[model samples]
Target: MMKNECSVVQDVLPLYLENMVSEGTTVFVKEHLENCSDCAAEFERLKSGRQIDEAAPQREHDTDVITAVKKKIAKKIFKIVAVVCLVFAVLFCAVLFYTGISYPVTKESISLSTKTDSEYTYIILETKAGKSLFFESKTEDILNDHNEVCGRRIVLYNVQYHNSFTKNTSSMSWGKPLNDEKPYLEVIVELENDTLQISNAE
Candidate 1:
């Protein structure tokens, strides 16, 4: 090789000693080193001279290329595993929702609950067949008793449902003090088939 070729080869020699050249370049270096004892002895000198870490090469990270290749493989494998797990989770959720069963993230409650004697509430359930599914009950209207509590309209149906068959203010227990003694109408619901229920009405 020419002096410039030898110099380029010498510049990459530290990397060669640590097995860090690209395969094509390594082959080129091997061909040159076999014919040139000067380069070969330089190679041997560098190998025996110092610990690999202490010998800072012209470049940093003697094995950066190989380490980067390994990292790419590991990252590809992790992405595949993550996509597979996400697919399984989505399938599981879809199955649960279609079959009306609870999956990992499915809420166990369809019923919302709160307490107060301040407002009246009601829900009108209509079927896909366009039929009203509930009976309107003859309950005493409780909206007449709504009063400002602490300077706000104390909404009750958020606590009480309006279609209650009867209204009782005293029978209601809120685990807290209510301003009213009459049983407030709050309905707890449980569902069966296409039919729905209103429970705990007082």
Candidate 2:
């Protein structure tokens, strides 16, 4: 009925190529193509290489999109780990430094031995840890005080030879010094290599 049959052909051309036309439109185009060989030939040529039945193949490569996302995630994880480790290390070192600084200086054991007689006398003072001990001394009636005896050395005792106590003296004397606060322990003895003994008098 339409004089310009090509108008129907053109209208159905797009829908026919896309395979989206209804069955009625397809049948109508078939009838029109039976009379018009030009559009039919054109349609066959247009559809020769192209297939509407098949969809496009999936993409081939990701182009580093996934890799970039992974890299960003890995970087964030590494930064978090680094921050945590750094904080722990700093806290641990701070605790250790604080403990070291606040710690007290340990005192060592002190051992002193003294031997006295009517003659020459000697004393050996030792520490358990090879460290120094708090000690001070005085002679005769020099003032013996804690603050005064810190770094000063005093004569232990005086020994007189060829004088009183002409006997072998091997005696230990434990007495409190009237001047010093600490109790005094004195040992009086004479080695028998030459001649020695003890004197228990008054």
Candidate 3:
């Protein structure tokens, strides 16, 4: 009879710890544990194990929540960095499109003329009508056989943007006087693979 009671108490111990056993079963198990040393020791061990079992899931849940939060934060940071890089790339391309020189000056794109005055002879460069273009001019001295500076060499570059935001003008002109002592014999417009030289003949 005592052996049977011990077995029943042990079986109901887990349910009792979880408060699932009825009050009558609870009283029976408690009275058996109070009297039997072996049953009391077994009940204490089961209670300690149940406490640890209950805490393990809470710890696991907390770790899972932390891991999920970290993953979400990482995803948000990646999106922000991606957007910033895209904006920087677009701005960099826009700067290149607006400021970079695109084409070389050509005869069909401009008209060249010379204006003579009492003191100086002016070389005139003008863009053709309805052209949305600008010019960059670089001047170098023409060298003779002895490396002497004989005249000036003017090279013009035509600049135009690829976008429609660029404003069109009827004409734009650049005029500079030829030096009296060493007159420029050539006004060169640099093409893609060749050059067009304007005759300075009066």
Best by TM-score: 3
Where is the poorest 10-residue window by lDDT in model 2?
Answer: 193-202
TM-scores for all candidates: the values are 0.25, 0.26, 0.45
How are the candidates ranked when ordered by TM-score, highest leading? Answer: 3, 2, 1
lDDT (Cα, 0-100) at 110 in candidate 2: 27
Kindly list the per-residue Cα lDDT of model 2 for residues 96-129, writing each as its tens digit. Answer: 6643442111222223455545543434443333
lDDT of 1 at 65: 69
- Each model's lDDT: 0.51, 0.49, 0.72
Off by over 4 Å in 1: 51-202
**Candidate 3 lDDT score relative to the true structure:** 0.72
Q: Give the count of colliding residue pairs in each prediction.
A: 12, 7, 0
Model 1: residue 116 alpha-carbon error in angstroms: 99
Looking at model 2, the pairs that clash are 168-196, 168-197, 168-198, 169-197, 169-198, 170-197, 170-198
